[model samples]
Each structure stands twice: as C-alpha cells, then as structure tokens.
Target: MRFVTDPELTPELIDELVDCWTDVSNAGGSVGFVPPVTADDIRATAEAAFARCGDDDHLVAGFDAEGRVACWLILGDAGSWLRAHWRWVLRVMVHPKHQGRGYGSRLMGAADAAARALGVEALHLTVRGGTGTERFYAGLGYVEAGRIPKAIRLAPGDDRDEIYMVKSL
Candidate 1:
C-alpha cells in the first residue's frame, strides 16, 4: 500500500472516497454511516472531512496496486494550541474488497508516521463498541482510555458504547 497525505481534493478523488466509504459501510465497516448507504448518503460527510485538510488536519489515504483507494483515515488537531501534541484519528475505513489485504494496518501505520512527522506525541480514536474494533487498535498498541455507554445509536434499540482508544508515540 502506498499512502499519501492531503492528496489533491479534486472531484475525482472525492468521488473515489465517497464510493469507497459507501462500499465499506455497506459491507459493515465502522465508518460513521450505517449499512445500506448510497454514495450520495456519504458524499456530504466525505466532503466535510476533506475540507478539514490543509491546516491542523490531514487526509491519509492508502492506494492499492491498481492506484485505487484501499483505505484511508484523518489526522485531526483539536484546534487549540494546548492540544497540539495529540491528533484525533477519525473515519478510518478500508474498502471491504481489500480487507484481507492488510491495508487497514498499513493505513494506520501510515497515520502513525504522519503524526510523528507532525511532531505529535499521541493519537486518539474512537470505535463504536460491540464492533470489536478496539482489539484491532490494541494490536497496534492503542490502549483503551475510556468509554461512554450508549453513545452511538444506530437505531432505537441498537445503541453502542463509544470506546476511546489512545496511543502514545
């Protein structure tokens, strides 16, 4: 996987990300939107994430051998000088078709390197509980910092805890 940061947010790149996010959500990947989502359903959020790049935030995208986005995530600053030592990792997603290819780990490794390059000391991210996403992050050396119960409501009866994980670099 070849990772690039803050790639040109052209229409083509945004469209590709929307498509990838749609597929990942539909395949049960934890990337904000629920399953059965269309590209249009994810377009606005994807655009907003892109708009966050170029300043204290960055878009780290990993491409496959064919040059398609296999996985991606965002490194976001908290917008305060006091919080400059840490970055929030958001919207981490791996195209379902490429899941078994280990792009998820590689994508995160890229995020780690990117954060280090920016003089960051810690990385924070949240996962919807019951998804077992914490285990994946733990494998990469992230520790559970805290959890907010019933924080994410996918539906009336389908609520999940929001697990906060952090890694000290």
Candidate 2:
C-alpha cells in the first residue's frame, strides 16, 4: 500500500476523482455535501476549489491492485501565516467498495507522514458531529479539540454539529 501525491492534478484526474467522490457522497458519507450527489455537482465545486488552491495544496491517494483510484484525501496548507505549521485533512474517504481493506488507514497514515515531512507539528480536520466519523478518527489517534453545535445543515430541519479534531505529529 503505497501513498502517492499529485501536486498538480490534471483535468482528467479531477473528473475521475469527482466520480470517486460522487460514489462516496451518494453512499451517505459526510463529504461536504448531501446524499444523492452527482459527479457534475462535485466537479464544479472541485473546479472552484482548484482555482483557489495554493501551490502546496495536493491530492494524496492510494490505488488498488487493479490500477484504479480507490481512495483520496486532500492536504491543505492552511493558507495563512499563523496556521502554516499545520495541514488540514479534507474529504478523506475510501470508496464503499474498498472500505475495510486497510486502505483508509494507509491513506491517513500517509497524510500524517507527509505533514511531518513538511515540518508540521499538528494536523486538523473537521467531521460532522453525532456520527461515527469522530470515532473513526479517534481510533487513528486523533483527539477531539472542539465542537460547534448546529453548524452543519443537511436539509431544512436536519442539522448536525461540526467537530474539530487534532492530531499532533
């Protein structure tokens, strides 16, 4: 299980990644969007984000033995003077078909190693509170640092807290 980083993602790569993300989102994973997501919707969002990314932002992913992209996470540089020492983990997920094969662990471990290599002392990420995501990160040695109540709204009356987690490298 080797981890690779694509610092400059191409158009084709983004399209492929959007497909992967669509699958994850449609399966009811909290990935910055509601369920029943579409590839076009995610692709447009990705285009906007790519336009704003700094040079150091990158895509960290792991491929399966069949040569398909099984999972990926974004490593954000925090994009600020004070927070430069930290990296933000964004949209980390293993496609539903690839889950429970130890791929998520390898993906997260690689993200941590990459942060350390960049002289980072801490990593940050947010997950929807009141779900199993926080537990998953805790198992990966992350500590719950904070939570904001009713911060994320999935629908009209459906809302969830936003949990902030930290892992010190």
- Number of clashes found in candidate 1: 0
After superposition, candidate 1 runs with Cα above 4 Å error: none
lDDT of each: 0.92, 0.83
lDDT of 1 by residue, 1-169 (tens): 7899889988998999899999999998888988899998888888888898978799999988899988999999878999999999999999988888788899999999999999999999999999998999999999999999999999999999999999999
Q: What is the TM-score of each candidate against the true structure?
A: 0.98, 0.93
Clash tally, candidates in order: 0, 0
Top candidate on lDDT is 1
- Model 1 residue 51 CA deviation (Å) reads 0.7
**Which window of ten consecutive residues has the lowest lDDT sum in model 1?**
47-56
